[model samples]
Target: MHFRHQTLSSALAMMASLACLSPLQAQTTGAQAPVISQSDAQHLTAAPSKLTLLTLLEAAWSRQPEAQSYTERLRAAESLRAASSAWTADSPAMLLQGKTDRPGSGAGSREVEVGVALPLWLPGQSQRATALSHAQILALQGSMKAQRLQLAGLVREGWWQTQRTQTELALAQTRVANAQQIALDVARRVKAGDLARADQHQAEGAVAQAESAVAEAQGAYEASLHALRGLTGLLDLSPDNLEATSEGDVSTPLPSADALASDAPSVDEHPLFAEAMAQQSMASAQADLAASSRRASPELTVLTTRSRGQTGDPYQQSITVGLRVPFGTGARADARQAEALAAAQEAQAMTLQMRARLQAQAASALARLRSAHTQWQATHRQAQLAQESKNFFDKSFRLGETDLPTRLRIEQEAVQAQKALSRARIDVSAAWSAWWQALGELPKP
Candidate 1:
């Protein structure tokens, strides 16, 4: 009795799977996916811990050497800012002099002097240098933000792809199980003189094909999982609820094209846009500092000397002050200034380009989101129609009215419809993720 119930359960499961497998679903790439290694499969099954896309990005941030390098540059810029003041422009220099002479007559004469020379900051030079340092720091901050945003996009896409392959694998496995049941049932009927030998053979061939498809889907899924792990830098990885969420149904209809159009222009205000502006500011500040530094600072030296001679000779004292200023060469100074000015102009051009690029990115993302959502709706309807057709074929097969080959054909179509619907749902989520990323919704991580 227990064995009979188990067999009945398997048959019922197969019935449902065949009915759901529409042609569109069957047309997905799982059967044609590249075969991965056994080791890869083993590596993927080690579900270490639950992880979300956000957490993955944060982990990636800690491991980003480029971001760290930029941070170090920012630190150096801070030091430069501290050194931009007039007092820090150059260290005070001390001058010392000593002399001793033995005259043909009385005593040896000795004199010692100490003097300090200080470089004076030109009126606007200190402020200009400080501003330059500040601008560099701002640029570094903006660059870090852009780097992180780019990293987040890669990881996000990887995560969604993993979900895609994983879901497809399950669907493939279901098809394999259903085909096996059909083969078994047909073989039993043939032995009992209820079905023809040709029917049994055809059903057996389907099971073989379905098993091969399962292997391909498994390999593709494991490969995708490995890629996700490589990007996140985790010792071990696990997928969270992204697959479920992405494949799940939406409660409301997607937005209209006009709404998306209205929202597209706002992505220019993303953090990446700010980064380009910061780069421009840094270049402009560099130009300002170069112009200010053209005028060299003057040095002032103050000295005092005292001498003693004979047993009770009065002490002799002298004081001296000197000022020096060196003129800058015109060719070199002008060239230096021109270089900075050119950099400023280049940076300004890049800033404008970045704004346009971001706006375009946002528009593209919005369009994809809408298209995917619409595809999901259309494919879902196809799936339902396929299901109804599969139901009619299922009834016909059970009554021995439809041959095994005809029934198998209908089942394959139903599976394709299932696959198409699943892919459409996954694409919708993927499009939404992309839209958010393009708009610089990637936070600090």
Candidate 2:
């Protein structure tokens, strides 16, 4: 009976010792921890150190059709500008005429004429055309910037989505590891007759739940990575190369609230607003050109005629000059003028609409950034309290003062708090990206 009493005391002491071991210490026993498959392990590798937001933006921009066509569009606009600077409104024409009267008079009588006609630009037409071409160039430039900013928004969205899923996956993996360690301890205790078989089953259930979460988080992470790769056209992107700072490591600080509030760029400086204004200017120039061009371009003709009155008469040559002025067709001119005027008015309205929309977007983005920062601070505090609670429960369970269910609940709460904290960090980064986007700025290196 004394020997049996000593054995029970030794078993109790062993259970107590195991219970005091922290999760990290328990994880050090390689053979007891559940094995993570190679595929899951690969997805959990450390982030690539060299990748940056600017690099992703450049990669995504390279794949865009608009980015490729920007140079061509600029060249076309320059050609229009060059054409507008020429002396003639249209190309010069060469005219020729010849006549013979040999059949009726039996006389060698003929006339030949050759002339050149030069089309003249109406007053101020060239200047207006030049102005229109300049406006087109400005509009193209603004449009390109706008397109790049739009693409930046997409990259930011994909990048942050990837970060969010990756954080979840990391947390899920940690949970799995912790649950597996607990299960191993519970199984040992059950075999030693210190814990019931039902407790072992409960521990195993927790492990299974954690593993299920890993599967779900893994799927989400892979999907987010694929979307980012599609946008960037980069097939070899590392899953862990995140733009946002990692948990517990803030190497790069977030923008301050004062900076965010005071550094709002002017709405007129935005590409969308500039593009709209350029369009309005171009339309106004078009209207002016149309108003000046009330009639077809007049032509000045210079000719040379060679003729003979009779068969015996010597051939004669003479030079002639004339002007050809076309009459103004009031109906056609009126229609064209009215169309140009309508386009100008429409462009004016659009510019006003664009300005208002950009201002609203900027305001919305600022609000979101502020809200995200507030949430991040709250989550940080919640995570700290949850961690403290978990530590308390961990010690209590080790001393036999707490049950398995209570300890598990505390662990879960801690994990949930950690998840919220990670999400909040990512949200703050994403909001800043969105704020830059709203201001028509691309992601900086």
lDDT of each: 0.75, 0.78
lDDT of 2 by residue, 178-262 (tens): 6766666666666778778888779878978987997787778778876776678655555324545322222335445654346
Point to the candidate with the largest lDDT: 2
Clashes per model (N, Cα, C within 3 A)? 18, 0
Q: In candidate 2, which residue pairs clash?
A: none
Which residue segments of model 1 deviate by more than 4 Å?
1-49, 66-73, 97-113, 194-198, 239-249, 252-265, 305-316, 443-445
RMSD of each: 6.2, 7.5
Span of 10 residues, lowest total lDDT, candidate 2: 25-34
lDDT of 2 at 96: 99
lDDT of 1 at 414: 91
How would you encode candidate 1's per-residue C-alpha lDDT over 136-218 as one tens digit per residue?
88878877888888988998788788878877777787787678767767877776789987877788789779878878877
